[model samples]
Target: MSSSTSSSEPTAAWARFLRLLLLFAAVPAAIAYAFIALVDPWGMLPLSLPLRRETVTTNQRFSYPMIAQDPRFDSVVVGTSTSRLLRPAQLDELFGARFANLSMNSGTAWEQAQLLALFTRRHPAPRVVMVGLDKEWCESGPLRRLTPRPFPEWMYGGNPWRGYGEILNPFAAEEAGKQALAMLRLARPRYGRDGYADFLPNDARYDAARAAQSLVPPPAAPAAADPAFEFPQHALLAERLAALPAVTRAVLFFVPYHVSLQPRPGTLDEQRMEACRAAITRIAKARPGTALADFMIPSPITREDTHYWDPQHYRIGIAERLARGLAAAAEGHPSAEGDYVLLVPPVGH
Candidate 1:
C-alpha cells in the first residue's frame, strides 16, 4: 500500500510542473502579439528611420534632431499651422534671442496650453510664449480631428526617456509607428527631405519675390463687428493663461483670416468670433503681465486665396509678416521683462 501511494504522488507532481511552464511561456507570446498588432509594425514602422538620403528626397526637411538639439530656445511660438510661417531663425535674428516654432497643424488652444505646461516643466520657462489665436480655435467644438495616437506620454509631455530617444534616434520605432499610422490614416504627409523646406522656408527671399509680383495686399479693417458672437474658449483661455508661471512672459496674437470667409449676420461664425474677441480682451486687460496684439485686420495678402493655404492659415510669406509683427510687439512692451506667475482667479469672481 505504501509503494502504490508514493508512485501516484510523483505522477501528480509532474503534471503540475508542466502546467506552470506552459503558463509562463504563453504570457510573453500574448504580450508580444498584442504590441505588434496595435503598433501595426509593417505599415507604420518605416517612419522611424532617421534622416536618410532616400527619405529626404520626398519629405521637405523635418528632422526631430533639429528640434531636440536646440535646448536654448528662450522664446517659443505656439499655435496651429497658421503660425508655422514664423521661423525661429527670423525671431532669433529680430529679438537677439533664441526661438523655436512649436506650432503643429490643427493645434487647439487646449493642446497649446497643455504644451505650455509641459515646456515649463522641463526647460527654463521661455521668456516669451507667442500664442497664435484664430477664430477657429475659439469655436466651441471637440477637437476630434487633431487627436494624435497613443504614444509614450513623454513624447509630447517631455518624458526623459522619450526626450533622449528624440535626440539620439529621432526616427525611433515608436515615432515611425505613429508617423506610419498617420500616413495610412491620411493625417500627415509622408516624410521627405523637402518636407522641412516646404514648411520652413530657408530664406525671406520668397516673401520678397511674392510681394514683387503684386500678389500681396495692404491691411484692411475688421471684416465686420458682430458683437453677439461668443468666444467658446473664453473660460478655457483665461484659465490656461492664468496658470502659466509668473516668470514666463505671454503674448497673444490674433491671426488674420480671409475677409471673404467672415461669418454672415446672425451666423454661428460671427457669434463665435465676437465671443472669442471679447474673452480675449477681458483676459488681456485683467492679466498683469499678459498683452494682446490684434492682427486680425484683413491685409492685401490675406485677400488673395494664394496668400493662404486655406481659409484660416496663411502662406509662408504671410507668416513672415506675422513673425515680424510679433517681434515688434514683444520689443515694444516693457511689461515682458520680469517673471510673473499666471494664477487662475476664483471661479465666481
Candidate 2:
C-alpha cells in the first residue's frame, strides 16, 4: 500500500506540472489577442471600433488599403511623389467630389492599377479617378511594371480572414500599441488624413546653374537608342475608368515639371515625351470628356524657376493653379491662361 501511494503521488505531481505549463502559455497568448482585437489598427476585425486618427502613422501599405475601402470618398488621386501636392479638400471643391490622395513615393503604374482595382472593388464606383501622369506611366517591359517593393497583395485583396496575419503581426502590434498610447496623450499623426506631408521646403529659391546640372543625362553614345517606353497602360487606365458606371470624370494631367527638367527640342528625351503624350492624347480624344491638361510643354509655369524648388517638383502654388485649371477644364469652363494647357476633347484634338 505504501509503494502504491508513492507511485500515485509522482503521477499527480506530473499532472499538476503540465497544467501549470499550459496556464503560463495561455495567459500571454490570450492577452496579446485581446489587445490586438481592442486596438484593431488594420481594420481586419469587423468591430467598427474608432481608431486614434490623431496618431496617423505613414503606413501607406496598410493605411491606403483602409482608405481605399472606406466609403466616404467618391474620388481617388493616384500617382507618384509628384502628385502628393494636390490637396484632397481643394480637389473636392474643384471637382465637386470627395477625393483622397493615395499617392506614395516612387509609385509605379502597376501599383496605381492595383490600388485602383482595390478601391473600385471594395467601395462604390468612384465618380472620378485622377491620374498624375509621370515618366512611370510610360514605362514598358518587365522593369516598367516592377515597383521598388512588392505591394501587399493580401492587404489589397479585401479579404478580412487573410488580413488576420498582418493584423496580429509583431510590427503591426507594436504600431497599434504606440497608437493606443499616443491616443491617450493626444499625439499628432505623422501624416495628415489626406496622406500628404510636404517633404520639400516651401521656399522656391531659383538657382539656374543648379537646375541646369540636373538636365544633363549620363554620358551615353548619341546613337544609343532611348530606353524603351510605352503608354498603352495609361490609355487603358482611362478606358477602364470611363467604363465604370459611377465614373463621370477621368482626368490625366502631366505634372508641371520645371523647364530645366523638360528635354530640349529634337532630342531623344523630347521625342519620348511626345510619344507618351500622343498615346495618352489619342485615348483622351477617343473617350470624349476625359480632360488632358498638359504641363510638360514649355509654358509660362514651366519656364518660371520660382514655381519649382527642384528640377521636377513644383511648389504648392503650382498645385493650386493646376487644381483650379483642371477643374475648370473638366467642367467645360475656360481656365485662365496659365502654365498648363487644358484640352478637353475635340477642342484640343
**lDDT for each residue of candidate 1 in 1-349, tens digit (9 for 90 to 100):** 9999999998999999999999998897566444433443222222333322222112112232234224556767667766766777777788676766666566656666555555554455566667888754677555433345222334344344334333223244444445445546634443321112245445443464453344333343444454444444566667766766666567777776665555545555556666666667678666656657666655564465556544665667666766666665654432142111122221221
Model 2 poorest 10 in a row by lDDT = 215-224
lDDT of 2 by residue, 1-349 (tens): 9999999998999999999999999998778867876776655456635754432446465567667777788888888888888898899887778888888778777777778787777655677878888878766444455455646677666666665555555766776776676667656555566666666663555565665556543432232265555665675576466565534577878887776766666566666777778777777776755777876767877777766667678777888887887777676565457656765542322
Query: Model 1 Cα displacement at 348 (Å)?
Result: 27
lDDT of each: 0.54, 0.70
Q: Which runs of model 2 end up more than 4 angstroms from their true locations?
A: 1-26, 51-55, 143-146, 202-232, 235-239, 332-338, 343-349
**Which candidate leads in lDDT?**
2
Q: Model 1: which ten-residue window has the lowest total lDDT?
A: 340-349
TM-score of 2: 0.80
Query: What is the clash count of model 1?
Result: 30
Tell how far residue 346 is off in model 1, in angstroms: 25
